[model samples]
Target chain A: MLKNYFKLAIKVLGRRKFFTFVSLFGISFTLMILMLITAFLQTELGSDAPMTEKDNLVYLPAISIKRAVKDTVVERDTSYQEGIMIVDSTVTYPERINSHSRSNPSYYFVNKYGRDVVPAKNYSIYNNSSYDFFLNSKKLTFRALLTDERFWEIYDFSFVEGQAYRKTQVDNGEAIVVLTQKACRQYFGQESGVIGKEVVFEGQTYTVSGVIKDPKSFHVYVNAEAYIPYTNLPPAVLGGTGLMDGFEVVYQAHTPADIPKIKKELEHRANLFEEFRDDYATYNRLEMMSYTFRERYADNLYDEDDDPAQNLKTVQWLLIFLLSLFVILPVLNLVNLNISRIMERSSEIGVRKAFGAHSSNILFQFVFENVILTFIGGLIGFILAIGMIKLINESHVLYETTLGFNFKIFFYSFLICLFFGVLSGLLPAYKMSKVHIVNALKQNQR
Target chain B: MISLQNINKVYRTKTIETLALNEINLEVSEGEFLSIMGPSGCGKSTLLNIIGLIDEPSSGNITIANQTVNGYNSKDMAHFRNEKLGFIFQSFHLINDLSVIDNVELPLLYRKSVSASERRRLAEEALLKVGLKNRMSHFPAQLSGGQKQRVAIARAIVGKPNIILADEPTGNLDSAMGNEIMNILLQLNQEEKTTIVMVTHDESMARKTNRLVRLFDGAQVS
Candidate 1:
C-alpha cells in the first residue's frame, strides 16, 4: 500500500513539473539562508574554539582607590591658565593627590623634613594644564599575579620555538619577553629570527626568552607585544598609583569546579587590604575572561566607552530574526504551492477513496512525497549555503574572521527543512484525504 | 454480495441542506451484473459511491459478504476495498505519469497479496485480456481513449476483486469504444464470475447488465 501511494505521488509530482519546481526552489532557498545565518552566528560568537577549560580562568583586577570613586574632581585654577595651584577643597584633593602617588610611595620617596610628609605631604594639587601635564607624564603600568603555573594550562597555543614563561622565570625576577608569532614577525622581520635576541620595551631591553602561542580567546589582549616578569614590574605598578592605576591580578583555578572557591578566597584576601578595609571597595568582583567576551567586548568594539559584547549580542539576535523571516517567507510560499497542488489532485484523491484508501494512507502518501522533495531540496540548499559562505569569505566583510559550513549548522538546516516540509504539506494532505468521492466523480462526469 | 438498508446521505452547508442520496436501499448478489442508470444529479454515482464503501450513508446499514460494514472505519473500508472491490472511472483515471503496465498493477500494489513479480505477471495478463499487451510501456497520455479505458479495466481486475464498480467507464469513449469496454466487462462477468455494479446514463449500456436500477432526485424509481 505504501509503495502504491509513493508511486502515485511521484506520478502526480511529475505531471505538475512547474509547481514541483517552485516548491523545491522555495524550500531550498529557505534552508540555505538559515544555514548561512547559523554559520555566521557560530563564527562571530567564537563558538568554534576548542578551549573547553576557559570557564575557570578569572581575570582579577587589583582593588584600588581609583575604581571605587564616584566622581574624580580636578579643581582647575583660573589664576594662571597653565600654571599649577594647590586646591584645598576636599572634593578634588584626594583625586589630585592620588593621581601622582604610586602603589607604595614610601619605597620611592623619602620624607625630606617637612617637604615630603608621609601621607598628607604626598598629596599635590595642580592647576588644569599642569595637572594635565602631570597626568600625561606619569607612565601607565599594569600589574598581575601569576598565582599558578596552570594560568597557561587551559589554552591552546603553539610555541614557535621556546616554551612559556616558567615558574622559575617569575621566581628569579627575570625580565623575559614572550612574543606572539604575529608580534615577532611584525617587530623583527619574518626572517629576522628574534627568538633569542634582545628586545627594547619601556626604555629597558629584555632578553627574548620564549615565544608563547597566541591566545585564542576573542577577548584576550592580543596586543600584549611583550610579557615581562610579574615580579620585575616596579613597586609603583605593584601597589597601584592612586586608586585608578591599570593594575590587575589574574588567577587560574585548578579546575572549573574550584572557581567559586577561588573567587571566595580572593575576595576575602582583597577585603584584608588597607584601602578596601572600609566598606569603600567592594571585594567579591571577579570577572571571568570567558564572560568578558560575552559581556564586556561590546563596549570595546566601536567606541572605547561602548561594550562590544553587547553589540555582538544585538547583532546575533538580529541575524536570528532575519534568518527566521527568510525561512518563514519561503516556507509560506511552499505551503501555498502545496495547497494548490493538492487541489489539483482532488479528483485523484476522490478516486483513491472510491478505491477504498484510508485517510491515513492518503495523508502518509502525501507527506512522504513532500519529504522526498524536501530532502532533495535540502541537498541543494546545503550546496548553496557552502557557496554563499565561500562568497562571504571572499568578500572579507568579516575581516580576520573565518566562516565555513560546520556539522552543527548542517544538522540544524536539515532539521529545519524537515520541519518545513511537514508543516507545509500537512494541511493540504488532510484536505485532499477528505475529498468526497461522490462529488469528485460527479464533477468528472460534467 | 452487498446490501444497503435505508441509506440516506445529506450534504449540509450553513444555509442549505442538499440531499445526495435519500433512504437508499440496494442489494447485489454474487455473480450479478447490476447497472444504476440516471441523468446528472440523479444520485446514480452517489449510490455507487455508498455501495463501493467510499462514502457513508447518513442513516442506514450496509452489509457486504454477510459482514455489517455500516460503521467500518477508514482502515476497515480500505481493507475491504483493496481485498474485495475494484473501481473504474469515466475518465479512465489512469495516472498520466505512469505507463500502461504500471497503471494496471496499481490495485495489486495496494492489495499486497502477490509478490512484485507475480503482480507484474498478473498485470500483463490482465492487460492482454483487454488487448493492450502491446501498449504496456505507453503512458496514459500516449494511449487512445479506448486504450486508456482498457488499461483501467486491467487495473480493476488485476487484484481479482469479487466486485468491480465502474462509474460510466465508457462515458468519454465513442459508441464503438463503449461497446468494446462493455464486451470486456461482460467477458469478466461471464468467465471470471465477478459481480459487477456500474453507473451509466446510456440506456444501451444499462441493457448490457443483468439487472438495471433507475434513480431520480436521489431516490430509486419503482
Candidate 2:
C-alpha cells in the first residue's frame, strides 16, 4: 500500500512541474539554512577533537569586583506662600551603593587562590595578545597565547612538527615559542624543518619550539597563531595588585562527575579572597564565578550580576524562538501551496473514499506523499549546504574555521527534514481528508 | 442484501432547503441486478451514493448483509463498505497517475489482509476478466473510453464485494462500448451471483437488469 502511495506521489509531483519546482524551492531553501546553522553549532558546541574532554573542563575567564561608594545629594527648597519664607530648608543625603568592575583574573590571584585553594586535577592560566611585524617587507599580524607549561596539559593541541615546550624551558624564561601551521607557512613559507628557526616579534627574537595545526575559530581559547610561555610577559603586569585583570584560567576535572565539586571549591576559594585581603573593608561583597564553555558563551551576553546558568535558559529560549520563526514562515507558505496542489486531487480522494478509504487513510496517504516531496527537497538542500560550507571555507570568511558535515549533523538535518515535512503537510492533509465524499465528487464533476 | 428505510437527504443553505433524496425506502435482494433510471437532478446518483455508504442520509436506517450501518462511525462504515460494497462511477474514476493494474488494485490496497503479491495477482485476474490484461501497464489517460470503464469495472469487482453500486457507469460511452460494459455486469450477476445496483438513463440498459427503479424529483414514481 505504501509503495503504491509512493509511486503515485512521484507521478503526481511530476504532473505539475512548475508547482513542484516552487514547492521544492521553498522546502529546499529552508532546509539548507537550517542545516548550515546546525553544522555551525555542532562545530562550535559539540565535543569534537582537541576539546573532547570539554565536558570536564571549566573556564574562569573574568573576575568581577563590587564596591559601594558614597554619593551625596544636596537639596535647597525656597518656596514661599504670601511672600513668606514658609518652606526654606537645606538638606544633604549620603547614600552608598552600587559600583562594579570586571576584567580577566590576574596571575597573582590565580597563584594564590586558583592553584592552592581550587580543587581540580589540573589548572592552566593563559592570556591572549596580538603583535605586528614586517616580514619580507610586508606587515603581518599574529595572535599570541602566553601560558604556563600546564596549558599544554589542559589543551591537547595537534602538533605537526617538534613538541611542546617543557616546564624547565618555561621556568627558565627561555625565549621559545610554538607556531601554528598557518604562521609557519606565512613566516618560513614551509610546513616543516623550521622548528629551530628564530622569529622576531616586537624587537624580541624567539626560537620556535614546536608547530601545530591551525586552530579553528570555534577553539576560542586556543585560536591563535603563536604560543609563548607566560614568563615572557613583564613581572609587573603579571603581579598586579588588584587581582581584577590579566589572565584567564581553565581547570580540568578528574572526571565529568567531579565538575560540580571543582566549581564548589572554586567558589569557596573566591569567597576567601574577601577575608584574605586587607582592603576587604572597601567593598560590600566579594564574589567570583566560573563556567563551562557553553555557560561562558552564554555569560558573554549577561552582566556581572546575572547568573550564567539562569541566563543560559533565556538564551536557549531566544534561539528556539528565532529558529521557530525561521521555520514557521516557510511552513505557512508551504501549507498554502500544498492546499492548492492537493485540491486538484479531490477526485482521487473521492474515488478512494468510495473504495473504502477512511479519513485517516486519506490523511496518511497525503501526508506520506508530502513527506516524500520534502525528503527529495531535503536531499537537494543537503547537497547545497555541503557546497555552501565548502565555499565558505574556501573563501576564508571564518578565517581558520573549516566547516564540514558529520554524522550528528546529518542526523539533525534528517530530523529537521522530518519536522519540516510533517509540520507543513499535516494541516492540508487533514483538511483534504475531511472533505465530504459528495463534495469531492462534485469537485471532480466540475 | 441491502435495505433503506425513511432515507432523506436535504441540501440546506441560508434561505433555501433542497431535497436531494426524500423519504426514500428501498430494499435490494442478494444477487439481484437492479437498475435505477431517472432524469438529470432527479436523485439517481444521490440514491446511489446513499446506498454505497459514501453519503449519509439526513434520516435513514441502512442494513446491508444483515448488519445495521445507521449508527456506524466513519471507520466502521468504511470497513463495512470495504468488506461488502464496490463502486463504479461515470467518469471511470481511475487514478490517472496509476496504471490500469494499479487502478484495479486500488480497492484491495485498503485490505490489510491482502499481501502485495496477492494484490498483484488479484488485480491481474480482474484485468484478465475485463479483457484488458494486455493493457495492464497502461495508465488511465492512455486508454480509450471503453477501456477506462472496463478498468473501473475491474477495480469495482477486484475486491469481490457482495454488492456493486455503479453510478452512470456507461453514461460516457457509446452504444457499442455501453453494451460491452452491460454484458460484463450481466455476466457477473449470472455467474458470481454478486448483487448489483446501477444508475442509468438508457431504457435498453434498464431492461437488461433483473429489476428497474424510476425516480422523479426526489420521489419514487414507479
Candidate 3:
C-alpha cells in the first residue's frame, strides 16, 4: 500500500514540474542556511582542542570593583584653529578598573594566594608601541602571556619540547621564554627542538624554554605567540603586577561537580578580601572558561548577572527561534502548493476513498509523500550547505573557522527535512480528506 | 446482497436545500445484476454513493451482506467498502501513476488477511480475467480508454466483493469500446454471480441488466 502511494506521489510530483521545482527550491535553500549556521556554531562553541576540560575550569576573566566615586581633573591637548591648547576636564567615574589599579598589588602565584593561579596578558611597550626584536634579521613581534609554574596547573598545553618557564625562573626574573610552534619556526630557523636557544626582543636576549603547537585563531582568548614569567617584565611594564587588569584567574576544579561549591568559595574569598580593602572595592565572578568566550573577547565588560553563561543561553534560544521562523515560511509555501495540487488529484483520492481508504489513510499517505519530497530536497541542501561553508571558510570571515559536514549534521538535516514535510502536509491533507467523496468524484468528471 | 430502506440525501446551504436522493428504497438480491438509469442531475450517482458508503444518506437504513450498516462509523464503513463492495466510475478513475496490476491491487491493500504476495497473485488473476494480463506493467496513460475501463473492472472484482457499484463505467468510451466493457460486465454477472448496481443513461445497457431502476428528479419513476 505504501509502495503504491510512493509510486503515485513520485509520478504526480514529476508531472507538475514547476510546482515541484518551486517547492524544492524553497525547502533546500532554507535547510542549507540552517546547516551552514549549525556547522559554524559547532566549530566555534564545540568543546574541542584546548577547551577539552572546559567543564572543570572556572575563569575570572573580569572583575568589577564598585569603588567610591572619584572626581578628577585631567588635562588634554586639543587643537583649535590649527593651534594646540591644553584643556582641563573634570571627570567623575567609579574606580572599577581591571587593567589598572591605583592600589598596590601582587601576583597570585608569588603571594601564594587567592585560592588559585593566574595567567597575565602582558603587552611589552617600548617608546609607546608594542616591543619587537630582530630575529634572523626579520622583526618578530607577538602578544605574550606572563605567568608562573602554577599557571600550568589550570591549563592543558601540549608542548612539543622543553617546558613552561619554571617557578624558580619566574621568581628569579630570568630571561627565558616559551614560543609556539609557529614562533619557534620564525625565531629559530624552523627548528622544533630549539629549546635553550636565545631570541632577541627589544635589544634584550631571552632564551627559548619550550615549544608548543600554535592554538587555532578561534582560541583567541588564551592564544599568544610566547609565554614568560611576569617577573621577567620589569614591574612598570606590567601595569603593576598581580590582581590587576589584563590578568584573569583560572580556578582548576577537581571535577565539574564541584563547580557550585567553588563558586561559593570564590564569593566568600571576595567578601573576605573586601573587608580589608579600601572601603570602596567590590568583587563577584567565576564564569566557565568555555562559556566566557564572548565576554572574554568583549574584554569582560559584562555587568553582574549578565555573565556570558546566561547570555549564551539567551542567544542560543534566540537563534533557534529565528531558525524556526525560517522553517515556517517555507512550510507555508509547500502547504499552499500541496493544496493547489489537490485540484488535480481529487478524483484519484475520491476513488481511493470509495475503495476503503479512510480519511486517516489519506492523511498519512499525503504526509508520507511530502516527507519523501522534503527528504530529496534535504539531500540537495546538504550539498549546497557544503558549498556555502567552503565559501565562508575561504573568505576568511571567521579566520579559517571550518564548517564541514559530519554525521551530526546529516542527522540534523534529516530531521529538519522531515519536520518541514509533515508540518507543510498536515493542513492540506486534512482538508482534502474531509472533502465529500461524491463531490470530489463529481469534480473529477468535469 | 444489499438493502436500502427510506434512503434520503439532501444538500443544504444557507439559502437552499436540494434533494439529491429521496426515499430511495431498493433491494439487490445475491448474484443479482441491477442498473439504475436516469438523466442528468437525477441523483442516480448520489444514490450510488450513499449505497457505497462514500456518502451518508440524510435519512436511511442500509444493510449489506447481512450487516446492519445504518450507524456504521466512517472507519467501519471504509472497512466494509473495502471488504464487501467495489466501485467503478465513468472516467475509469485509474490512478495514472500506477500500472494496471497495481490499480487492481488497491482494494486488497486494505485487507489484512491478504499478504503482499497474495495481493499480487490476486491482482494478476483479475488482470488475466480482464484480458489485460500482458498490459499489467503499462501505466493508465499508455492504455486505451477501453483498457482503462477494463483495469477499473479488474480493480472492482479483485477483492472478490459480492456487490459492485458502477457509475457510467463506459461513459467516456466509443460505442465499440462501450460494448466491450458491457460484455466484460455481463461475463462477470453470468460466471461469478457477482451482484452489481450500476448508474447509466443508456436504455439499451439498462435493458441488459437483470433489473432496472429508473429515477427522475431524485425520485424513483418505476
Candidate 4:
C-alpha cells in the first residue's frame, strides 16, 4: 500500500511538471540556506581542536572598570516674590569605565587564589610597536602573544617539535618563544627539531622552545602565530600601577566538575579586589575552554554549573526564527500546490472510499503522498546545500574556514525533511480526507 | 445479505432541510440482483452510497453478513466493505495516473494477507473476466468508454466481494457499451452468485434485474 501510494504520488506530481518544479525549487532553496548557516554556526561554537577541553575549562575573556568622580559647582536661583537671589551648591559625577587596560593581568592575583594547576596570561603581538621581526629579510609582520609558561597546560596545543617553555623558565624571565609551524616554515624553512635555535623578535634574542600546529582563530586564547615572555615586551606596554591588570587568566579544571569551584573562587577573589582598592568595582567576561566568545551557550551545554556561553541562546534563537520564517513561506506555497493537486484526485478519493476506505486511510494516503514529495525535495536541498557549501569555501567569502556536512548537519537535514513534510502535508491531507463522497463522485465527471 | 432499518439521510443548511433518504427500510438478500430506479435528485444514488457504507444514513440499523454495522467505526466499515462489498461508479472512477492492471489491483492492495504476486494474479484473472486482458497495461485515459467501464468492473470483482454496489455503471456509455456492462452484471449474478445492488434510470436495465426497487422523493414506492 505504501509502495502504491508512492508510485501514484510520483506519477501525479509528474503529471503537473510545472507545479512540481515550483514546489521543489522553493523547498530546495530554503533547505540549502538553512544547512549552510548551521554548518557555519558549528564552526564558531562547536567543540574543535585546541579548545576540545573548552567544555571543561574557563578563561577570562576581557574585563573593564567603571567609576564616577564628583565636582562641586555653584548655581544662582531666583525666587519670585521679592526678586531675591540665592546661591545653591550641586555636585554631579558622570560615570566612566576604562575599557582599555594593559594586556597582562596581574600575576599577583593568580599567585594568590590560584591552585596548583594551570595559570597563564597573553599579550597581543598584533600591537607591534614593541617588536619588529625580519624573517629571511622578507619583513613579515604577524600577530603573536606573550603568555605565562603554564599557558600550554590550559590549551591543548599539538606540538610538532619540542615543548612549551617551563614555569621555572618563565619565573626566571628567560627569553624563550614558541612558534607555529607556519611561522617556523617561513623563518627557518623547517618545522621540526628547532628547539635550541635562537631567533630575534622585537629587539630581543629568544630561544625557540617549541613548534606547534597553528590554532584556528576560534580559540581566541591560543590563535597567535608566535608566543614569547611578557617580560620581553617593552616595559612601556606592561605599565599598570596597582597589580598589572589586564590579560586573560587561563585556567584548567582538575575535572569537568571543578569548573564551578574555580569560577566561584575567581569571582570571590575578584570581589575581594574592592576591599583593597576602594573606588574600583570588577566587571569581567568569561569564555570557558568549553565555550567560545561566539557560542556562549547555556550552562547545560556542557552539563556544568554556570553558563559560560553567555548570550548564545539569544543568537541561536534569532537564527531559528529566521529559518522558521524561511521554512514557513515555502511550506505555505507547497500547501497551496498540494490543495490544487489533490482536488483533481477527489474522484479517486471517492472511488477509494466507495471501495471500503475509511477516512483515516484516505488521510494517511494524502499525508504520505505529500510527505514523500517534501522528502524528495529535502534530498534535493541537501545535495544543493553541499554544493553551496563547497562553492562558499572555494570562493573564500568566509575566509579561513571550510564548511561541510557532518552528523549534526545530517541530523538537522533529517529534521528539516520531517518538519517540512508534516508542515506542508497536514492541511492538504486533512482537506482531502474531509471530501464528501457524494461531491467527490460528482466531481469525477470533470 | 444486508438489511437497513428505518434509515434517514437529511442534508441540512441554516434555513432548509432536505431529506435525501426518509425512514427507509430495506433488505438485500444474498445473490440477488436488485436494481434501484428513480429520477434525478430522488435519492437513488444516496441510497446506494449508504448501502455501500460510503455514506452513513442519518438514523438506521445496517446489518451486513449477519453482523451489526451501525456501531462500526469508519475503519471497521471500510474493512467490512472491502471484504463484503465492491463499488462501480458512473464515471468508471479509474485512477487516470495508474495503468489498467494497477487500477484492477487497487482493492487487494489494502489487504495485508495478499502478497504482491497474488494481487497481480488476482488482478489478471479479474481483467480476463472483464475481457480487458490485452489492455491491462493501458491507462484509463488511453481506453474507450466501454473499456474503462470493464476495467472498473474488473476492479470491483478483484476482491470477490459478496455484494457489488454499482452506481450508474453504464450511465456514461453508449447503448452498445451499456449492453455489454448489463451483460457483465447479469453473468456475475447468475454464474458467480455475486449479489448486486445497482442504481440506474434505464427501464430495460431495470427489467433485467431479479427485482426492481423504485423511489420517489426519498421514499421507497415499490
In every candidate, what fraction of the native interface contacts is reproduced? 0.51, 0.66, 0.76, 0.66
Off by over 4 Å in 1: A1-22, A33-50, A60-151, A167-194, A197-217, A221-239, A247-250, A263-330, A389-396, A439-446, B14-19
Clashes of each: 15, 0, 2, 7
Can you write out model 3's per-residue Cα lDDT over B59-93, one digit (the tens) per residue?
98999899989888889999999998989888888
Badly placed stretches (over 4 Å) of model 2 are A69-97, A218-220, A239-245, A256-286, A301-305, B13-15
For every candidate in turn, the CA RMSD to the true structure comes to 12.4, 5.1, 9.7, 7.0
- Who wins the lDDT comparison? 2
| Predicted complexes: DockQ each | 0.37, 0.58, 0.57, 0.55
Q: Per-candidate TM vs. native?
A: 0.74, 0.89, 0.83, 0.81
Candidate 2 positional error at B82, Å: 2.2
Off by over 4 Å in 3: A17-19, A22-32, A67-141, A182-198, A237-243, A271-310, A381-396, A400-406, A409-413, A444-446
Residues A1-446, model 2: lDDT tens digits: 99999999999899979878988887788777877777777667766656776788888888766776667666667777888886565666676658766678777787677774345788888887888999989999999999889888877889998899889988898999999998999999998789889999999999999999877655768788899998898878776665766688888988878888887887777666664357545566555678887787776666443587787777777778987776788788888888887888898898898888999999999889888988898888888888898998899887787776775666676677678777677888899899988889878552
In model 3, the Cα lDDT at residue A325 comes to 87
lDDT of 3 at A277: 51
* Chain B TM-score, one value per candidate, order as shown: 0.97, 0.98, 0.98, 0.98
Summarize candidate 4's per-residue lDDT along A203-292 as a digit string, tens digits: 668889889986653344666667876666555545433444544555566565766666565555554445335433443322222233
Best by TM-score: 2
Candidate 2, TM-score vs. the true structure? Answer: 0.89
